[model samples]
Target: MATRAELTEIFGAEGVISLPRSEATAAGLSEDDARVLCDVGFPAELPVIFSLDVPGDPSAFSLVPVDTGADITKVLCLGGPSGNSEMRYCLDMEDGYVILLTLGRQPAAEIINSTVDAFVEFLYRYGLRLKHIASADDRQADEYTKQLRQYLAERDPQAFAEEDTWWNMIFDRLLGKEF
Candidate 1:
């Protein structure tokens, strides 16, 4: 569950902003999808590692929309870097899966989590782990990274189902920079 208090704690009170139901509906979102966006809303502007930014509008659903093979509206782009080939975070309304539309001509959209709640939780968890990483030893850092990866996989196996997922890319970058 992505309760208000939990989100506030993760992305300060000022940072959190609920997605508008009207915008979601206008974007061809389902009732359940609209409800989820309105209820567990995300930060309209997040510049963190697990980031999804909609600076122009408040949690706007209007951006570079993509067709994820299935249908023209299967993947709904929330926000990210501009352009069609840029990194865009999206939502698979019907499946309730959060997508990290990566850059490349290949399969651009990859599942970030099975649900938006898990995605929020992952962002919170990753941030916490990053804050405390400096205090940990080399061995501790490796263990913590492994634990976080395992936790994320357990939370949503579909997100980590592929070897070259967005989650894997994040972990790889983390290793390259930190460990």
Candidate 2:
């Protein structure tokens, strides 16, 4: 998993948001999962994909048990791509896998990552490349994006296992420069 220092280098300290261990656990994440989140923190928004919505205080903290009959991490993406629909990115309470759930359609839940660690690594690598891509020419941007995709595939094959997987969809969106 990427360390907080590395994430800070990519996203800046303010851009990374994380809850304390007690809050994360109260929010339904496993101790291992909570450790990664609390230790490294995650990006506020990975544009064209999802945004983080971790509560700032204990009073506002509560784990959402989605329509799938599965509990989800509170540090989740609550809305759709545009922050409007019922789509959400949640870490399954039973398993540490990150799931992309479309409420009311439980069958459509797509596994976003095999594990929270993989998810964090993806976020870190993606954010780092985005920084590099921002200053590059179009050719360099394409090459960097391609390289990032390759890295993700090699790092977490399960995430790219299906054609309709979130990571695959995200690559298409990256081409459109949505992030």
Candidate 3:
């Protein structure tokens, strides 16, 4: 698992900011989780945020508050909106597993990765996917996919498979397939 310092090195100071401990505490995060959040902070920008109803409206993406008061057990909102939002990402407080909460879909909270480290890796891979989709040339995309596969395999093989499956489902849904 990558440490906070390692993540900072990977993401850079501009990309990753340390969250205030007070804010993390107020958000009801556990000590270790709070440390992780406080250390690496949240992603400055999520590369992907597409609305199901409106595809081109940039206003569709916004951060939603993670309600710790909600009835769901042992889950913390990592980023993104809830309710009307098509997808919301979360973390399982108990084990640091990352989960995807898809609204209006069966089996709502899909476990995407086994740990926060793996989850961060997933974010990096997802960003690559977005870039690949946008770029005209396939060379960069192929290289990125190759590197990401190696990173995931080295970090956690199981998470590599799970993230690939989850991203496939997510991409399918984004492309107009019903969840």
- How far residue 145's Cα lies from its native spot in candidate 2, in Å, is 1.0
Best by lDDT: 2
- Least lDDT summed over 10 consecutive residues: which range in candidate 2? 53-62
lDDT by candidate, in order shown: 0.66, 0.70, 0.55
Stronger candidate by TM-score (1 vs 3): 1
Best by TM-score: 2
User: Against the hidden true structure, what lDDT does model 3 obtain?
Assistant: 0.55
Where's the lowest-lDDT run of ten residues in candidate 1?
50-59
Between the candidate structures 1 and 2, which one is better when assessed by TM-score? 2
Segments of candidate 1 deviating more than 4 angstroms: 44-48, 54-60, 63-65, 68-70, 81-85, 102-107, 177-179
lDDT of model number 1: 0.66
RMSD of 3: 6.8
Q: How many residue pairs clash in each candidate?
A: 0, 0, 0
Candidate 3 deviant stretches above 4 angstroms: 1-18, 49-72, 81-84, 105-107, 125-137, 162-164, 168-179
Consecutive 10-residue window with the lowest summed lDDT within model 3: 50-59
For residue 107, model 1's alpha carbon misses the true position, in angstroms, by: 7.5
